[model samples]
Target: MTVDLRDRHVRAVTPAEQSPHSYFVFADGRLLRVGAGSTRCDPIAEVPSIREIGPGTGEGRESELRLYVHGPWVCVTERFGVNAALVNTATGAVRELSRADYHADVSSYSIGFLDRGGRTLLVAQTRWNRLDVFDAASGACLTERIGEVEDIDYFHSLLHVSPDSRHFLSNGWVWAPVDMVRVFTTEAFLTGYEPTSIPVGTAFGYNWDRPCTFVDARTFVLALDDEAAEHPYRQLAFFDVPGEPDERLEPHTLVSCDVFPRNEHGEVKGELHYDPESRHLVALTDGAGAFLVSPAGEVSARLPDLMVGGHGGQAGWSYAPRHRVFFRWNGGSGIEERRIQDCDRAEP
Candidate 1:
């Protein structure tokens, strides 16, 4: 059965922000905040000069600007990690991140807020095979040269820090162009405890840039396509991080579903966001709309159409656990909020 969770609609100047409880839009030197269920788009602050810094070569960058909003904090990073800045929406203070040389392929560089509070920042230098951690608020380099000395062939990209901020997941690819999903202790790596990379599941030559969301501090869900040599299914696989260093990480197929909306080369054409309150993964596919999939792999409900932007203007989808709603921004002048209360009809 298809369940539609359409709730309310709000207007925005730019589809620039996706955080937990609100939508932030940056336009005309101003930052606007839209609460999850409110129609008011309040002008939060006169945003300082946080411009896009880079060669702007437009050679292989994904988008000119990427916004990560967490509570009152905002981090804007160039798509290729050439430059970035951390902004406090409440105070109007800005901290510019250290710049790096541009790399053509986006998989070469990634920048994002590592934890749920937007406190820790991570810039993956895939070209150098190293990860840099930072204190987001104070602009202090917490640690550098992480995974740099490891004798591995993985170009680390697509970082996702767990809810408790204990584990870190990287959906990076390798030379043969295979998508390798890895998990490790976030604290251990930053503190020089477990400097070596821990292995997770690998999907050879399939499911590159697919979506992943953490169910908790120790378990995460990963999307993948069929690859007989590895996880042989177009499904969402749940994997648990080993508690002990000697334990092994394994992928368990919680449910079977199509990993669709793939591009020409069969890459990810969608995103996955988990709502802990409702206990469902919101699968936002580019052209195919959105689906509410349970952890047991059942399609509880679906909204058949979501305005996922064109080309580089892809829609940003996020869930507000406070309101139990999924927000979709299409880089235009409006945002959509869909309530998942109808999902209660699905089995718990």
Candidate 2:
């Protein structure tokens, strides 16, 4: 049941400007901007002819948790977390998969759907030493991988599969200090590979993340707060993963930056924005301001607070590789597309 996601068919929720191009398809045929766990896209065609499919058994309560989107299908779970459903993007079809397997009692912690078909893969965490996987079509477990995962202890674990399904990461899932982040080759992990961790920090114990950007098949940039073994003068560590599937993930260029002091009010501090075009990265230190740095690690520009924010791009700009520009947006506001040179002119 794989759904083909053709050109501009990608889904997004934060960058509202992506609405016209990237989209989330709904059962009712409306293509809407992206939202978490329960939002449906308004189908692109204005398909008045496509009738809305009403909720099936054990579904369509007042609240729906729209978790992940793959192709045209969206994984919908309920507020109770015990139940899960998949809404077909094309036919508006809905089915319940969570009610089966070990999920009769445990809600799945993370989900992955094969992009070409609608098969569901779920990951659930329990008791640190073990994890559970439930297969959608088979309504059972991939017992082999489950036994392997149980031997690895990932703290406060959550699972994420890469866009190409080649790599995955296990770390703190929600909003908490991103302290122990680890990346693994998707193939190696499933096939059972032993490895050493690429250290991010040591010395002092403070860390956070702006979401690791998976820029390409082999190149991704990760930001974290740490002292790293015994280094002084810097509190941040940036690691560039070697990305060879079987090789150790040693840092090709592990750069560190001056510690951006956190806000005493508990607000998040020191955000990073990478503009691929300029090959630049921006760090917005709360209460202070923002500074743009070159790939060689030199400060290039100092930016002011976001016009509306006392800080810089919170959910600010992401490099739109397709558009060759920066896509900037805040909350539900409209998005702004800008060239990297237009930094001073654009907000965040």
Candidate 3:
């Protein structure tokens, strides 16, 4: 499939997550739900999901608040040592919860609200080597168990709930520094689990610190380490989730691209975004343009001169599928709209 850059455009403003009828924009300690309350270039009506923090008082440092949204639940939380809540969409009901023991150490980990079937009623917060799932509806502990990483620190680690909701996978090097990645079930986690309760990916890796995700219920994709010493490239691998509980795991290289660039500090300056709609993986960078990678993990197109951090740092871009358009923002520049005729990724 092929993508033409000539059909795209850019803009300058803050980006947001676009739900069907609402535009969810976030700041440090704040979340604004914008919707059909007005008619203009941007969202007119705004609702602060956070109403109160402590004893009817509304005050806190932006640096101390962490914001996230899942389905109709918008979570505005304290960095580590305090409160967390799930904000409802329709009636704006706020469900407050506790994040007291969330071992938010040194920041690569993420917390997600877990849903059973189609209902989201639990919260999953990654702690030391285990994940603590809380009752989002009642602010109670649902369950907890050992995770893939021995030590998932405060910096970059990988944990993604599968789209199919069957499994959740994670990988980090801080703990045992082993090549094996971890996978656990959503049901076992929501229901309950033991210390020795095993999931899958029992022996799933030949590398470390690489990002991976579930391709389906029984298969997944991983970005292996760099290939060249002189010019580094991101090599991707595909592996089948172990069939039997004791089956050995195997991963084969699928594709590679030198899309990862380093900053002056030599740190990776971009983030990889998987577009399920296009079946393409996009590398959005702090330098250069976006490299659209195929499902096979090959770089297919490069749309340069555009500013995007995927959903990194904060919400910087919002894609509206119904409108086939996306908005780009950078805080200073006003919002720009780009039209997408199709993201079919068809070959020219």
Which candidate number would show the highest lDDT if scored against the true structure?
Answer: 1
Cα lDDT of model 1 by residue, 247-303, tens digit: 446786556786345566655556787887668787777776667788888787776
Question: What is the per-residue lDDT of model 2 for residues 1-348, given as tens digits with 9 covering 90 to 100?
Answer: 222223232223322223333434332233344332222234432323221322343344333233455545555443223444555555655555433323211222344443213455654433332444446445465535434232433332334455565655554322232345566654454455324323323222333233344444445555544334355443334444444533334445555554254344222344454555567665555454555666565666654542213234353334433333444433333344444465544443
RMSD each, Å? 6.8, 9.4, 8.8
Candidate 3 residue 218 C-alpha distance from true site, Å: 3.5
- How accurate locally, in lDDT, is each candidate? 0.59, 0.42, 0.47
* Residue 335 local lDDT, model 3: 39
- lDDT value, candidate 3, whole model: 0.47
- Candidate 3 stretches with Cα past 4 Å from truth are 1-21, 27-29, 35-67, 77-83, 97-105, 138-140, 144-158, 176-181, 191-212, 227-234, 246-250, 262-269, 307-348
By summed lDDT, the worst window of 10 consecutive residues in model 1 runs over 1-10
Best TM-score among the predictions, by candidate number: 1
Error of 3 at 56 (Å): 26
Q: Sort by lDDT, best first.
A: 1, 3, 2
Weakest lDDT window of 10 consecutive positions for candidate 2: 99-108
Mind giving the per-residue lDDT tens digits that candidate 3 earns over 14-118?
223444444454432334443322212322222343323322122352323445566656665544334555666545666665433433432233456556755
